[model samples]
Each structure stands twice: as structure tokens, then as C-alpha cells.
Target: MPAASPQPRRPRAGSRRDEAARLAVLHAADDLLVEHGFGALTVEAIARRAGVAKQTIYRWWPSKVEILLDTLIEDSDKRLPVPTERPTAESIRGYLGDFARFLTDDPAGKVLLALIAEAQHDPHTAKSFHTRYLGPRRDQERDMLARAIDAGEVSPRLGLDATIDALVGPIVYCALTGSSIPRDLADTLAEGLLRPRSN
Candidate 1:
């Protein structure tokens, strides 16, 4: 579990000081989520943990979920390296390979599981997760599938929604089951998607 670094009380606007404070808040939130779980986390607690004001958190984010969403996005930038320069199949394979890595011992992996649990019973969290995170990624991949269709790499009639699920479903299964994803699964999936299917 990562501890939040202490930050200055009033950082100058647009300064490295200011950015440090912002990162402190994010780090504090992640630490709290890890140490206490989301149920025990609060804006007041986050402020105390970050050494900032509650208003400081509110000035930028509307809710704790938004804070977690930002932290998750940051984690994705560091972990998920999709090689878009490659063909769609390769990019998607790269993505799944990275996705599998995150599900394994990462702090963000706990966040993913917590968010999944929250989404099941909480409609608002589900909507926020979809709108702020999941939906955009799904749409991006859907666009990739559309391009693959145009290039005749995928069947023109393939339903992108199902195709996206087919590609992602295994990763989700790993996330849920806490199983280690095989290294070759990405290549297997890419081959299954791009290969000519025999009836």
C-alpha cells in the first residue's frame, strides 16, 4: 500500500507546487481506498490524509468516484500500451496483454475489483464508471473494429458490440476469477478474430 506524500498547504497556482498538491490528493485517495476500502473513505478523511482542505478536493472533483476514476486513468496510461501503429489485431493484442498484467498484483487491480462490485449494486456508480471510463474505451475499440471491417481484416457484417465483448470478455474473466492470464492468449485472440473462419 502506497502512502500519501505530505504536501504544502497553499501551493501557488499553475506551479509545480500546485501539481504536487493535486497528485497528493490523488495519492491520498488511492491510499485510503487501499487501506480502508471505499466504504470507509470520505472527502474529510481524504483531505486529512492528503494534508489539504476538503474544499480543495471539491473544487476539482465532484465525487470520490471521480477521484478514483482519475487515478485509474493515470494507471492505464502507465500500464496499457496499445501499439496503434501496428495493425488493429496487434494493437488489440497488445492491449489485452497489458490488461492481463494489471489484473495481477497491482493496486489498481483492487480498484478495478472494487469498482466492479460497486457497479453491480449501485446504479449511479455504474453510470459514472461507464460514462467516465468504460464507455470511452469500448467506443475506441469499436472504432478500431469498424476500421478493421473497412480494411477487410474483419468480416464486414461483424457486430462490433459482440466483437468487443469477445475480445474483452476473457480479460474480464481473469479480473473476476483472479486467475493469471496466459501470455499466448492475446495472440490466440488476435488470430481467432483476424483469421478466416470455417463453417
Candidate 2:
């Protein structure tokens, strides 16, 4: 019997080419998000911009919303750093202000608006947003609030869930409304929620 022909080598798992391709796709998606709202985004547009085929996008993301969601998560991950120190009211103010500034900055803010708009119209996108983005953020803030309560910086009288809403609700409101919340206002909002209520 003739010897079997040599098999073609497979690409390495962590090849530089693969990493560059992935980054290109993500960068394309990010740029499109800024140029057009999420509702206007298409997988074809992303693939074309990235210099890849539609199959390449679908192979990684199930839908356009998923692509945008992942892109937003990855981009935000680098820009925002959660505080590691003990959770005090001051720490909460500082962290939230930094996050708010991020949201207001170019590209990131636009992406956030697109995601929120998409979530309003599509249930699957909404679920993905909650699970992939909102859920993790909520959990992280909840832990920080818990630590603040333990530190006596926040009143134990405030319910954990309620406090979470209090900290996040205003931010969401401003983001969706496309309005600015004054710099001093974020600290005040935190104080209003954390301060002890006299019986």
C-alpha cells in the first residue's frame, strides 16, 4: 500500500494571526457602532469592514446584538477598573464618577446607547444584555455595597437590593436620557441612599 499523504498542519491555538484577526473584527464592530446605531448595524457590514467573511462573524457571535454586546464588554473592561480597597462612600463616589465619565466619552457612550435601544426592541438581545453586561455589573456593585454596610459607611437600614437600585438607577436614567449628571450630583446621590434615616 502507498504511504498516506502527510496531513496539513493545523493552526496553533494562540497564533498571532488569529489574535490580529479577532482584534480587527472587534475594532470594526466598534467603529460601526459609533457610525451607526445598533438598530442599523448588520453582520455583513461588520464582516466587510473587518475584511472577513460573514461566516467568520457568525462563527463567533450568534447575532449582531451579540457581537455588539461582546465588543462593548471587552472595550469597557479595559477602560473601567473596579476599586479593590475597602468600600467606603467616598470610594463608591469615585468609582461611579469614573464610570459615568467613561459612559459620556466618545464611542463608549454611543455603544451603550445602541445596546440599550436594541434591548428595548429585542427580547433575546435584552436577555443577553442582562446576562452578559447588566448582571455582572449589578453583582459587582452589590458586593461593594455589602462591604460598605460592613464597614459602617452605609446604613444597615438600607436594603441591599434597594441600595443597588439607588446607586445604579440614576446612572441608567441619565445614560438613557442622553443628559449629563453634574459631577457633584453622583456623590450626593450615593449619600442620599447611604445616610441613616432617623425613626
Candidate 3:
């Protein structure tokens, strides 16, 4: 059996140096992942790159994977936020477009893809990836779809997960395959999925 994942260490509050070190570690992890791929990422290498002791990183994160997860979560929160407002097809289209760009163009997206690829081979990483990242994002998407359904803006024929797959699958496929995502792919997806089906 794979060993249990390490528990994260929480740093004390109110230290500016602590916060700075945390940012440095996150940045260093991202840079290393982009430069050398996940296979080459290590706590020692990250410590050298960030100019901080390895123990400092361990004080805040459990492992190199967790450090990368931190970088992904921070960037995803900023770049892929689901708006906390009423549903509109136009607004959803905007979000879809932004999301497509984020996945295809953002460094954070690269990090996410790397983590996902690694997760395919590591059961522990798969669990952590879902629990910390994919699960929450999917939950947010489900909530938005639920709201849209309640508002009668979208049909309830397919359940939330299927609807989400319909909405997000193509963009993700393009990202994974290195295909060029069209500028209007989001508009097409949103309109197609939101269009009323003939009875």
C-alpha cells in the first residue's frame, strides 16, 4: 500500500517573513515544474531555488506536491472564479471564454495539467488532486448549474454532472491534446448547451 500522505504543517499567524517565504516556495515550485517537469521537482531543489531552508517549506506544506497544489489553488482562485450571482447565458459565456483562455494560456493551467498527469500514476496524488482541487471546482460548477436550472435558464434533462461534462469537456480536451482552442469556442459551447431543445 502507498504510504499515508504527510499532514501539512501550519505556520503561526502574523509573521511577514513567513508569508514571504510561503510565496517564495510557491513560486519556486511553479518555476521548477515548468522548467523541469514534475519528475524533477524535489523539496531540496525547491529550497535551493527559493533560497529558504527545506524545513521552512515543510513548516507550511507537507510535500512538493502540496506546494504545487498551493500554487494552483491560489492562481485558480484568481483566474477561474465562478461568479456568485444570478445566472445568465451571456455571463456564463464570458466565464467559459475566460476559462478556456486560462487553461490554454495561463501558467497555473500548466501546473494543473502537470498535477493531473502525475495523478494518473499515483493513487495518493489522485486522491489529493480531487480532494483539494478538482472536487471543489466541480462542486462550484454544479452549484452554478443548479442555479441555472432553478431559474429555468437551462434544461434539467441531464443531471448536474452530465451537464457540466457537456459544458466543460471540449475545452479540457483541447487543453490536454495541445489543440488550438478557438477564440469563440466558449461562445459556441455556451450557446449550444443553453439552446432549448425541440420537443
The reply for model 2, stretches above 4 Å from the true place, is 1-17, 196-199
Superposed Cα deviation of residue 51, candidate 1 (Å)? 1.8
lDDT against the true structure, per candidate, is: 0.75, 0.77, 0.83
Q: Which 10-residue span in candidate 2 carries the lowest summed lDDT?
A: 11-20
Colliding pairs, model 2? none
| Model 1 regions more than 4 Å off | 1-17, 81-83, 155-158, 196-199
Clashes of 3: 0
Per-residue lDDT of model 1, residues 1-199, tens digit only: 8989988689756334367778888888888888998898899998898998887788888988888888887876676633445245556667777777776667786677678778899899999999987887777667777776666555623477887687778877877776877778777876776553334
For each of the candidates, give the backbone clash count: 0, 0, 0
Q: Tens digit of lDDT per residue, candidate 2, span 1-199?
A: 9999999999665433366677788888889878876667788999999998787778777887777777788877778756668888788878778777777785765777788777888898889999999888778778887887777776844588887777767876888787886777678777777774334
lDDT per residue as tens, model 3, 56-128: 7776678788888889999999888986699766667778888888887888888988888889999988999
By TM-score, how accurate is candidate 3?
Answer: 0.85
TM-scores, all candidates, are 0.76, 0.84, 0.85
What C-alpha root-mean-square deviation, in Å, does candidate 1 show against the real structure? 9.8
